[model samples]
Target chain A: MAGSSVSWSERAVRLLRRMNSFYSAGSSRCQCWHFSVGGMEVGLVPPAVLKQLRRFPEVFSFKEEKRLELNPGLASYHDRSSAVDRVLQRLREEERFTCLQGWRDEKYEVMPQFSDPPLMCMERAATSLFGVKRYGVHVNGFTRQPDGQLAMWVARRSLSKQTYPGLLDNMVAGGIGSQKGIRDTLIKECAEEASIPECIAAAARPVGTVSYTYEDGEGVFAECQFVFDLEVSSDFSPSVGDGEVHQFYLWPIEKVKDALVTEEFKQNCALVVLDFLIRHSYLHPDTEPNYLELVVGLHRPL
Target chain B: MAGSSVSWSERAVRLLRRMNSFYSAGSSRCQCWHFSVGGMEVGLVPPAVLKQLRRFPEVFSFKEEKRLELNPGLASYHDRSSAVDRVLQRLREEERFTCLQGWRDEKYEVMPQFSDPPLMCMERAATSLFGVKRYGVHVNGFTRQPDGQLAMWVARRSLSKQTYPGLLDNMVAGGIGSQKGIRDTLIKECAEEASIPECIAAAARPVGTVSYTYEDGEGVFAECQFVFDLEVSSDFSPSVGDGEVHQFYLWPIEKVKDALVTEEFKQNCALVVLDFLIRHSYLHPDTEPNYLELVVGLHRPL
Candidate 1:
């Protein structure tokens, strides 16, 4: 939430920024499990899930266990997920959420217990996993002004998109939609969102992630958005590489600040840009009373 | 809360920084309330407290209510609090806990609901109110290097201090004790800790705040430390005026980074300086994969 002193666009951005943050208790009752098809104790499934799981004994198991677990005897992850997918397909029909979107052949790694060995390699469809955590990256494409100032590249998202259509977005953003690498995601997003060549897109750095947990009536949304800052040459011009972006705009830091502090840009973009400003020394702790608060508040403790 | 990459002092600082942030659920089972000596709905007092309040009906009231409350019709704030103070003084005798400190005649405002227009103002002896929220200011003293680099002033608290004695700290830090304003606290602390003259201290700019929430068996601790950046001249040297500080040192950004990454500073001070490093462009997103996460994670949502 934003304070009254914050301008309009900034308020919207602050709220949007809250999408990946921790505010109150999440509404989810389902547990999040690991790649090994083990149950994540943090999540609590509704009572009805017991009856439903009973119907998929081959795919799930509780038989005298502490919590639900994926049948360890499954042949492969593909076999297990496809079985779970079929259940979800039927669930979609039963629940009548035809408008559901974001399903993909690729999967997102959930409950990443380890980064090196990846102790539990849990994978699920990019869609149908709303009640758990997800990951993505948002990049800020910028250039140094002649006076040594910073100017940013902003993308006007395509109106046809489902979320925040026609609103402003980061220069590049893409989900960790599959079992893909962070650098690969940045390169792919850069090429699609801003027409940056793959080689140049690969130069985009992976900074860190911004995380949040929010839940509505449907399910809880816990996400970690990795943030990036890619400095482009002064002569660089961005074209809409994919149809997802309507157009691109190059604006100085002041104009970008106007957009953010006044609520003109899309919501999450506010968080990305605000981070940019603070890290770049544009927003000083002395000048902004909430500076340290925003800095420490953006990430969740591991 | 510090990651494995963070240093020991930095990790300690991060933990101290968590005292006021509401990332996880607070320990209090009771709901928080306001207005006229009433039960603090949130905090769970020991069962023995009922007898204490019963002894101070003139100052405190919980005769029929479940929560704590102040006598609404008290003649003056002092009259009401003095009555309550007697109860606490007597409770100390019963508990037999020695060496309790911070019992100043001053008070701190509890539950600042609005960025502006604070809702309920309850002042209490600073010592006895550790379980509640408190406000303070922390200033980062910096100077420009002749080679276009940034160097900072660091302070070491006196061994005689009650908290984190002999530990590294920001150049200036002081609680918003009594009715002191944020700026006033900064100026006062600067002079005391680093012997920076009042006029020079006044030149400091107000940065944002750093917040966190923490709890132990004793009580829940919520704190907001207003941050500042004061630029000093190269020729200046600090002479400790207050007994609280033992010494001061001037070091460039590189040494400061070593201290932070190696965990040499006090816990909250680590966060303050880490924010400094990122904002000053010492840590860039291109090089640090966790840049956005750190920025967004620093501040808690309102």
Candidate 2:
């Protein structure tokens, strides 16, 4: 299993680099690429920017450049002022360029408006808003109610989200590329997205990382996700971040699965949640539904 | 296991640098500090000569100098030049420097001589004399004897070796940083060290790497060795390189183990050969001989 994870990570890295190269040729300014190095995720800037950076001996040194090249997978950002202007023009047409006010909680904030290409906008949102691309681990904390059913806390995304607006996700899902590892990311995401407290996050135990590729009309995307299992008290209530998350729902596992099958859950929310359940063997053993096969094969015809 | 090897290599590298530093400071000319990059071996020049080298950009580039600071372990040479000169200055002192010469081929014209402080010889002879420190994979080839025993073909080191003169070693072993992986190095090392045909080297299969630490009275060294396994016809006769190697030896497993225990094998030769056997479980399963433990613990008393 460890070998498989390493292989997957290697493949993911290759795919990411290939994607970066493909996208880089089209943009005037190079995009920032992130990759795992020495178990830590770091961002690399484009060669053009790096060349300019070399001139500033005080801020950067050539010796440091040699050190960075030792790990070749790190990505770099290129000059993109013109590209940003073009992206901003597109944003004006969509009326989605309104700046958001900072939220009351210092750590929790709405995505800032960006006048840029959708891809550039997404990159900016991921960096300036979410910080960086990271591996996210999710744990499902649940217990049997008096009625003999398992219940889990789920967070709903705000309708303002550009993608998957008004959809349910894991109680905590964030990138591991952040300063912290999976546990820290989970706590931070849960607190900011669902308002889960430190006490609840502390009880979580990491299961493993679940990886999947997601693509829309925009571009290809990959995520290294982790899941943790936590058992919260029956009466546990989470304070949802109003600016980021809309509401919180505590539902039985069976009901979640039912919603997935009945087309009740939003977008790929059901599939993602179901994937987590099946991976952890939370579902009944005898019920061997081929949901993954169906979902994996489902693709919009080009 | 990989992490442990990295840490061990790092520690060995640190000790080696410290040893070089001590030798460098004691020398007047400071010429004894010669380091190579691309390959991590350091060459110690005599203090008087080393002073000339420090200012000679034609001989050593600035890049090589930078690499020395980054990876001190590659510093293979220490100004043992003065030591060698002192020994050569007196007939009795010359005896202190052990001498061994191995023929490169049947012509016996180009025999390479290795000394304790290695010979400061011509470039071609020097190249073959120096052990290129690099990563390598070890492979074990097998053949059945008429008596129903397994016979292994091992290379005999040249007599003029600084260490392990006239010792038997792996069928193939070479430094890794030479822009060659295990397969490539095996082919080259076998050809030069044992006179094996290129076709046979091509047929060898890499099994694994055997990493070990060696400390002589002078300095500590670490090697990332790759092991390979091959099967040959029983009638095959190894063509020995008289210029580099005196002769070839084929011994059964029992004789090999016996030689290791009796110390009949050359210095440090037993560890390389015996460790390969133990790691691959070639020894009888029922017999619990702690040969590796014994040899590894036999540290030189300060």
Candidate 3:
């Protein structure tokens, strides 16, 4: 697929910069106060969140200069989880935050790092409000044609989905809830979203991750998606199972590359596809001037 | 083939952190002054380099407070290159920097980013002294065995080599000179170092990159390696063409993973192989707790 007058690499980098805007120097969110718990910086609190947080003086603190700290007195993980949950429930009832309207009743772990012990857990919808790190697994489904060319399976999100409705997504994607592990979530999502059998889904390979942080009206979103690539037989097709995905289309890799710069795919999902293109040697250094930048952008520290 | 007491993921992260020690919090080099060229921050100048730069007032200016800027008066690329070259030549003759002992006639472009127009060119050996970004091509030579298992071809550097002598290296690697392009250099290096034919080398897939910045006693080292994965036919074996490599070993994937923690490979080459493992699903999120961190560390901003 031929790129536009402006190379696809340039457009891809622009999209990545937008996704990582919060971390860019001189961005307004870069001025946001640090959100810390147990003296560990876990998230970023925007100005609006900071103001609202001031209302819960016993639960949140801004006493340490430009930092918002959870009450260190909430010693155990359960105590901290309950303390924050109480505040979120009050905010939901008061309709103080719009993000709470899409609450999935799911919880995400809050920790300094992914491998670290959880400091607390927060509602899935409320994660962006606190700018806590969110983790998910995204599967890149593809198959090899008889002509020896590769094609990717792209999913159009159901119009009824709560977030990013009707947008293009990977074949299977789901957040890793506090109660679930990465692999379990991945395999479960594959079967539920794409109707792929557990045996085939189990063969999906974990191929590193893509991470970025950006801030919007809702709050700040810092996320990392564990990426996987699954190659299925030519005759295999993924049909919608749970209706989260409206439709699945198997398109040539060339067509997928053309769509990448259009921003047609969900932002993070576009990154997953971009990583696939690079790994598969489609977006090469010889032709893509922004190759290195794209690589770094996809793997930013969460 | 088993990891030692420590998990391979932890050891890999520890090694990556060591390679990227300069960017970690509280590192001495983090306190170094920014080295700017043509109004762009292209490098980092440590205190030792700063002290020596004071000898050439006409070319370098550090009066800006915690920033080292090449004389703005040297406007054109040739002018800047010549001025910097004069000073470097002086340093070489006066034996001011021990790193110059391994001087390479090759020159590296000084730029804010790889695709940008270079402000000037500096001797490759002096890049570390100024902490400029240096890029090279590293090929992960691997092949699929008849049993469906994978193995990697690892090279042992000649003892006479100037840098990292007698250490393990990738099958093929070479720095990208200012005048040569990425693909040409990669193809050339593959042929020169491993005696790979042009047709075979042309099939190498440009997977991605591994970048890091570290500061040692000599100076700040910031570098990025353009990574390529070349899956040679099982019948094809790479032979040493250049004396830079003393021998080559084709090790099982499991053995390669085991050696990753020993630090037996050249620091950067180990990273290239580790990246290979992740890309091919050998190091997985299901088992590697540091999966995301390893992904981020391998692609740090240079």
DockQ of each: 0.19, 0.01, 0.86
Candidate 2 chain B lDDT trough over 10 residues, lowest sum:
B106-115
Better of 2 and 3 by DockQ: 3
Per-residue lDDT of model 1, residues A1-302, tens digit only? 44667564345335644554334445333333321354343232333445555676777676443366667665465665567667666655566333234333455654432132221223343233434456678888999988989999998889997666888888888877546767777888787777799877776755455665654433445666777778999899889877999989999988887776554577667667776775566775434554544655455543
Off by over 4 Å in 3: A1-5, A28-30, B1-5
Predicted model with the maximum DockQ: 3
Q: For each prediction, how big is the interface RMSD?
A: 5.4, 24.0, 0.8
Tens digits of lDDT, candidate 3, B1-302: 44577777778888899999998887777568898888999998888888899989999888556888899999999999999999989889999888987788999999998888889999999998899999999999989998999999999999899999999999999999997888899999998999999999999989999999988877888999999999999899999897889999999999988887785778889999999999999977877888888999999998
Candidate structures ordered by DockQ, highest first = 3, 1, 2
- Model 3, A8-97: lDDT tens digits are 767898889989988878665766788899989898878877777889999987765788889999988899999999999888888888
**Candidate 3 lDDT for residue B248:** 92
Best by TM-score: 3
If both were scored by lDDT, which would come out higher, candidate 2 or candidate 3? Answer: 3
Alpha-carbon runs more than 4 Å astray in model 2: A1-134, A137-139, A176-180, A261-272, A279-302, B1-302
lDDT of each: 0.61, 0.41, 0.90
- Sorted by TM-score (best first), the order is 3, 1, 2
Residue B268 of model 3 has an lDDT of 87
The sequence of per-residue lDDT tens digits that candidate 1 reaches over residues B220-298 is: 4456677777888998877788788888889888887677544457766767787677556566543454554455544
lDDT of 2 at A94: 47
Name the Cα RMSD for model 2: 20.8
